[model samples]
Target: MVGQPSAYIIKKLIHDVETVVGKVLEDRSTEAAFWHPDRRARR
Candidate 1:
């Protein structure tokens, strides 16, 4: 790990966080946890 540059590690972390946030945003079911109406059931 020490062999990796700081910029590369930061970029990887940002990419991973974006991937997860994008996925979670795309899925409507997750809304129920914050609000009501599990809209994912419709699809």
Candidate 2:
């Protein structure tokens, strides 16, 4: 948005984003695994 971000800030931002995305996906998959019998078959 402004000037170039610092390396440490960039790394922290990326790490935070990945952690959020990974947790969301993990939770969704766990729900699907528990509720969807054909999930693996469809995959």
Give the CA lDDT, 0 to 100, for residue 40 in model 2. Answer: 46
Q: Pick the candidate with the highest lDDT.
A: 2
lDDT of model number 1:
0.71
lDDT of 2 at 8: 70
| Candidate 2 Cα outliers beyond 4 Å, as residue runs | 1-5, 30-43
In candidate 1, what residue range of length 10 has the lowest lDDT sum? 32-41
- List, residue by residue over 1-43, the lDDT tens digit for candidate 2: 3465687788889999989876776779876566665874587
Ten contiguous residues minimizing lDDT sum, candidate 2:
32-41
